[model samples]
Target chain A: MRKGGVVVRDVDSEVLQEVVVLRFLRNLFRRKDTVEYLREAWRTKPSIAVAEKLFHRLQDTGSPGAALAFIREAGRAYPHAQRLRDLQHQALRVRSSEEVKSLRAALAANPRPEIYARLGELYRYLGHCEEALEIAREGIARYPQSGGNYLAIGLVHYSRFLKTSSAHDGLQTEACLRQAYALDSASFKSLYYLACLYVYAGAKPMASECIARLAELMPGDNRVADLAQRAQALPDSPQGTAADYFRLHEARAMEAAAGAPGRAEPFAGLRPGKPLNDRLARIAALPGVDGVCVLDRYGARIAGAGRSGDTACNEAALQGMLEGARVNARRMSIGNFSRAVLRSKDWQVFLYELEPYGLAVMGGRTARQDLVQRKVTEFIEECLCEEQGA
Target chain B: MKRILKELNRTAGIRGSMVMTQDGIMVAAALGPDLVEDVVAALASALLTTVKRSFNQIAAGESLSELVLTATDGKMVFLDLGNAYLVVVAKRDLALASTMVEIQSAAHRIKNRRASTVQRQTAAAR
Candidate 1:
């Protein structure tokens, strides 16, 4: 039930609050016929419930669009209601590919990670590992606290490991799998992914941990449990594709950067042939790139522009942006926006994803947005390519 | 009418201008980009009518403040300001977060001016 990779949360808070207030207000009104007032609240409450039932019914009949329309209209009539949203989630299962595309149109106001995770699954099911990897990364970025998000990220990497050996980034892939394990060792998806990584990395002990955890949580998730058992049953040695599988990633990155706007615009104030300075220059001059800096995924700035010398806060802001971008893309379906532009009258931060490395573009409030997106998109894709090459 | 609207647009970041009859006729207007001031000035009455309904629901025993409609075009905002005018501000790619601060500022200043002007004219006639 994925539409534009948005995950509807368990409840809509505004609606619950409003409904409670309405009940209190009705009670406070003086001299109304007892049955009349109670009946009115009852009538109003079920009006929303009826909408939910109708939406679910439509979804059951394979009409997610109609269900969504029903929910939207119900939401307008009852803007502060949780049940209406619950009903919308129920209809998500009936969605079609076209509905998923339309859901992207609503990403600006969309903030659901559950949808992103589901979208990743759908893509993976369709054998689109690259897309699945991209969105799963985005999903994890937004909701690091979500066990589901972590599993999605791990699954992408594990799947990559199963693919072309020369097309995956093992170091970053392991990091992603670790995060998945950190959140929920018992998750079937995470255990499956972890088993794959462990067998690949030749770390049977870690593989055993994943197996034990899976047994505790699912008890009958024998597929991964059995895989872990098989790895243990065999020698604790690694054997798979000869070359590393990070080449394709690097190629994709290069393709993206080479295609970036202002490809050779003097790297924006920084001259070429200056060591990593050229990399910094290239990052800055990227279209939609507001500013540039390098960092680990944990937000430790290595090098770049616009630091103002406050390394501590700059790093914190960078990490926050990375997480925020992931969440933003998942919730809104903006298509893997590790690059974000947070602007007020005061400050702004732009974050971009580049595998084990992170690229951040930040500036004052007056930074040009279009120029920044184009540039950051270029740099991110390029960085991914470079990291894979290394 | 042109003079009255001149004062509104020249106030600050007023990019477009218009004047409307209570029945939604365009007395005079100036607009920019793809927007037509007369058409918006006509819709302005309908928007005001919506505001009137909300006002009635409140039972505040006070007057209506102002009506504002805000929109985006991927990069900036096409903000409909005041009951008669629509101002389209070129903002960030994400218009909501970008133009909101500016739109709110513009709305507050113009709302006070228009509300007080209507009150003053009504009082003068009395």
Candidate 2:
């Protein structure tokens, strides 16, 4: 496979590494005493697989949330183990049951910040604001230093703002998000919410700063583009804060989780751009067009074809050209970016801002633009169809 | 002067903060015991200069207003102060948007004070 103009030749070797790891884990898992085997494996190899197996075994006893509680409790005992930290991080995303009983039980067993954070978020998600606030207050009091707790509190306040459209709740949301970001600037959840909050508050400068950082954290994520466009569209202090933006984000996330038309579709089954690459190859085989390149919202190359020699089109250069044109288009107050045609001494580059992705087709200047445009449109529509079908 | 930074530090998850001149001379710092004040000041100065230079390179006449570096271990934020720069070392998961606003406000307060001081000096000289 070619990535960034370089051929990746280690596919077999990488597959072998995965196979070896699973095989080793399978032998250990097949043992009569699984718990002891996990302990021994954790003490020896200390791999992610060991932690995963432990989490799985704990899941057999109860919910994944309960499994996480057990892992976190075990982590306290094995403080020096690196795998424990890995497990702790993984525990944040683990979902089991959001029912009041399960949450309260998990909280009673392990009153750690992770449980508080999860319970608080679940409460907020379920529209139990009072319960969420209670959990947030208790968590903050217990783990004042934990950023995740602050993030939960911030999220709960944000929920309030969305519900009541009260300026007080909005301000509280801002303060809480600030505190959460202060506690951990690297938290994507905090950064993302803060950016969206700023958008609603009509603080474009601050929103842009947050979105830029988020772009760095989650490169190629389509949501960043959506958030950025929404942020830019927001007028400072618009009548009735567009609460629907947050709901849109939530709806998209729910869709993504359900294997609908979202980022997950591109990455879940096939490697990103694997399907796109197949389409690009067909475009490359077309006469006149020298190469076809696709870039994500952040101008990072998703996939490319051609450029086998010095005279062929380079993906990175094409990406830069498209980005420059995009910035210029925004600066000029162009309603929206449609197409850019760059005539160069070597190649004629055609750029199109496909929603969530950038498309660049480089060909000889004499190449038919009419034919190329049709082909590009056909390719984009087909890719969109694939995502919808997926 | 120190009170402003101290109040900022009282916020949850802020590990340390430092104020330094453009030349990297440390003016004040409320850093943790493990961090060296002068070293952090120097690094902050270097990061600011490098970032500003890059911005200038990309778009002439443009200067950097702020910079945030997030690492797995922690986060560092630099806000451009008129006569100096404020560098804050925070937790990796710090709420960056609010923190940036707080830092920017602090820098604005410092700038206002300096402007008032200069005005008073001018009146006194007259």
Reference-based TM-score of each model: 0.28, 0.32
Best lDDT goes to which candidate?
2
Q: lDDT per residue, candidate 1, B1-126, as tens digits?
A: 455445544534445555565556775665555556655554455544433343322222333332222221112122233454433322123333433565556545555667888999999999
Candidate 1 global lDDT: 0.51
Which ten contiguous residues of candidate 1 chain A have the minimum total lDDT?
A262-271
Runs in model 1 deviating more than 4 A are: A1-99, A102-108, A127-134, A137-141, A200-202, A238-390, B1-126
List model 2 lDDT by residue over A208-284, tens digit each.
Answer: 88899999999988888889998879765433333444444345544654563334424221235566676676667
TM-score of 1: 0.28
For residue A385, model 2's alpha carbon misses the true position, in angstroms, by 20
lDDT of each: 0.51, 0.64
lDDT of 1 at A3: 57
Task: State the lDDT at A143 in candidate 2.
Answer: 91
Q: What is the lDDT of residue A385 in candidate 2?
A: 31
| i-RMSD of all predictions | 15.3, 16.4
